[model samples]
Target: MNRNTPTSSKPVIAIREADYGRLTALAQVTIDKDLAVGDELMAELERATVIVGEVAACRTIQMGSTTTYKTGTSEPRTVTLVYPGEADIEANRISVLTPIGVALLGLSKGQSISWIARDGTTHTLKVVSVGK
Candidate 1:
């Protein structure tokens, strides 16, 4: 889907089944520390289409995938989606437990998602590219 495509109430997202269990567990673990983002991640996972195997050829974003994305009209940023323990903002490694990370997960290149921040601000994030 390109920028011109009309995004739905929530765009379709696909997640590898192999990552589902671990992701869900991660969300659960973070609930106490960050209820809002954790809940958001769980909700996103609940709505995702789980694929059983590899989708290496697809441009879908997954854990460990390096992606370039832009929020609203901001400049594009490259980040590696990683687990909380591995997250390092200075290195551009984002934790799936964060709002932007949850928003990026499962999205394919060219697709965009609107998410609410902890401070109650809404933002649109578009995936420019995805690389494993």
Candidate 2:
């Protein structure tokens, strides 16, 4: 298969149309700072199905959405998704540029995503809930 193909192992994700442009710009700028994660984020965005004209009704994880997710058998953690400048671990705000944030983006409740950590270990995160 080609490089950009979405393999069956990767779940299809949905992104809001309004967020697409900004996200693309973010991903592009991130490449200079972190190649692996930046490329991965760009790929994810490229393959996502864009939701149009239904921003308020979307249940998928997006910027500013508070999400609860679990990894492995660990307890779920709740965090608010935010831009890089706004991230504060103490505040439970996660930056979309981070691996966990990228994995959680565009996912709805019960959706799971697999991502490679900066350490190169593979991990999976399952979305338990999403709240605005």
User: Root-mean-square deviation of each candidate, in angstroms?
Assistant: 4.9, 2.8
- Predicted candidate 1 versus true structure: per-residue lDDT over 1-132, tens digit per residue: 011123347788888888999999888887767577777887788788898767542568998999999997789999999998899999999998888888899999988788777676778988999999
Per-residue lDDT of candidate 2, residues 1-132 (tens digit): 112224567787888888889999999998867566687778788778888866542688988889899999999999999989999999999999888888888889998878777786778888999898
TM-score, predicted candidate 2 vs. hidden true structure = 0.88
Cα deviation of 7, candidate 1, in Å = 12
- CA-lDDT, candidates in order: 0.82, 0.82
TM-score of each: 0.87, 0.88
